[model samples]
Target: MTEAAQKQQSEESEKRERSPGGKFMLVLLTGFLLAIPLFASWLLIYDRQSQSEQAEQSIVTGWGGQQVFSGPKIVLPYKAKVQGSVEQDGKTVTRTEIVMQNLYLSPEAMTFDSDIKTEVKSRSIYEVVIYNSNVTGLATFKLPDDFARSGIDPATIDFARAEIRFGLSDARGLAANNMLSVDGQPLVLQPGRGLGETGNRGFFAWLDATDLADGTITVKYDVKFRGTESLTMVPSAGQTNWSVTSQWPHPSFTGGFLPKNEVTEAGFTAKYAITNLALGSALTSTQASQQVYPQSNNRPYTSFDSSGEPSSVTINLIQPVDLYDQVSRATKYGFLFIGFTFVAFLLFDLIGGVRISSVQYILVGVALILFFVLLLAFAEIIGFALAYITASLATIGLITAYAASVLSTWRRASMIGGLLASLYAVIYILLSLEAYSLLIGSLLIFAALAGVMFVTRRLDWTRTLQKRPSS
Candidate 1:
């Protein structure tokens, strides 16, 4: 062959190499990219160790051993009635009312150390609710019957109390699942002594009801208590001024012997006299209390189970939140974005035969991969929207630059960028949609694939794959 011809042939061969190795690499990359959504879904469902951490961090309240307060002894006498009618199969047969008196006596204690004033003063606030309504009852907290039964004299209890308020209520059609609220708030029990030395240190505020006509109501059972509670709250840096807490016991309600599920919560508010510093305020607390089931012709107030014998009670904290589920929800749309991007790339190459260079493909893949990391990081800092924007912008910039350089056209590069930006926007919209996202995203993917198929219908795949003009 002539030397010039030989050189020309060599150049042609180089141009037409097409690189089977590159195709193989593309196959592998495509497979891996396609697998990302599956892996993400699996991670969301199975590997949510992160959610557990977030839940622990977010829901827990008290840490260090801090005795915020112990109030003075208070005597309380309360009366309440439960009324309701049960109708089954279109027949109103049973109408019942239960009335009872609660005699409560309690010993309270509080701590203080202040240069501003020698003595510390604190006021306790009590609130209550029932059947999503407020039921008023006695405001004063009393000593447990167990204390008097143990032969512990009431005179031995020290005194540092303030004025107490009283309340009464009539609740109708009370059921086990009926909702109870304290101080116009839901109850979330945490591990700590709320008031007394025993686990029973908590207080309850409720409404007064004589009939269902009043609906349930809420009342502020405030006790103008004076004592030292400076020890309950110590200043800590980088902590919220007002602390919030919650807990969910395994079985929910405590059997009648303890703080039952019927009483949603017991919370106290402490204020220091000298510095007037208020701390240990319960924004909300909740717990499961047991239901009192009266057996046929038995002691009226006796709690018995379905077996009709003295039933054992099992209680658990009602921690309703699953942090992992929440975080997973935030990432679901990101996974969808990545999955459809892979599908689009596959469709374009299979039909248009306008193959992207390996480097360009790698750039796009990297952009897709980094999106989740960016989302997780930015979400932790600035929130979901900012995190998504930062991630999408970064990926868009990377892919656009690579597209322009590899496709050798500014217009093509911008086109890819706009398309990617649009896709990201759609993903964000889906993420925000919550319940409707799955349906909308399915339709979107279908439409996108249809467009790709329609546009590339006439392209000659073999010719485009061969050494041809860049039409």
Candidate 2:
């Protein structure tokens, strides 16, 4: 045969490859190839998500980061004697040295009222949560007459240079913390860790408790700070009450201790009533060098900060919906869209007396996959809801128009259009009802299979595509 004759024979043989089994294999094959773009779209969504997170992190860098704070603990210093054997005169002799040691005293009563002002900040297409926390609180401390038990005489306790300490996760958050009043005596704030683990990332003030040896020492403070995302507080007194109110509508409470909380569209109010009895520890320690919150590995004096730890109460200011997350979820349904579109085309070609080539199948499938990319792109600018509608409409229009020519009738093409629109709508519903998505998706598949079974129940499968005419 001539080359042209052989080419015509090959074309005729390819056209003969049609009907139910042929279309099923072709769709399976086409679906396989379409996986590439669907996978690529998923990767693109993650890459954009990572970039958004990096942008938010950069914004937080300029502002203060998450803030975790503790204390109104007293640091009382006293003289102590240490005895050691020394080679003083070419012979081992007992040497006595006097050293100044510190004793940490927690408050008998402590209370704080925190008011947080929140604002949304955007960089590029990313947004971050930032807040200013204004804290006003008071603490009452009482000295016990049991100093002699720690090997320090009451007369040896130096009350003149006693210090009151506090802890914060980030020192940069101390925006307006400078001076405070202790028992009506105005005192200056000095930044540094005085004692042990509790000394991390906070400020302290020197107070003379000599006159209050037989009475109670009181401290009152009003300070302001800046932070992003989360906040944490330590219950550092025998009895503690912390009340926090914020205008941020979305708040997540986490950590070791949960609060009695109320949430509203306007904001949230969280109140914590804690006591040394619930703290699972004592109120005071002699020469406290041990970690105050042992399980709280994230406090910054040790160079760590986490959203929630078991030893402290944490509050997270959160975004109501994560756009990237929703986009990623939408991509997970990419294959469903492609499969349904391919099946719709296959069914119409098998019984509607229309012919659909593998190329048209591929084109429609590609359009379905492209929807994810479009959704992700628009979601960054317009948000998830509007972006879903925009992307779905664009994709549905492109495929429905292509289907009109491929199916050879406006009637069959309209069915394809309606099918695509319905699939998109069901996908949106699945995304919304995350808890029931699996159940609904399974029922949708079962219904599709039942419909296909009913439609082709009486068709003579033994017959090939040559028997059916393009009516």
Highest TM-score against the true fold, candidate: 2
lDDT of 1 by residue, 1-471 (tens): 999999999887765545434454565576466456546654744444455344443332222111222222222222234567788899986666543322222212122221111121112211111111112221122233344463333343222221121211111111123223333554322222222221233333332222111222232222221111112222211111221122211113333222212222332222222111122222111121112322221111212345553322222222333333444665555555555555455544554345655555555665776666666655555655776788789988887887666555677668778888998887767766778988988899789768866866775444424543433
Candidate 1: residue 175 Cα off by (Å): 31
Cα lDDT for residue 238, candidate 2: 78
TM-score of 2: 0.84
TM-score of every model versus the real structure: 0.43, 0.84
Cα lDDT tens digits for candidate 2, 337-402:
988888788777777767777888887887888899899889989989999999989998888788
**What clash pairs does model 2 have?**
none
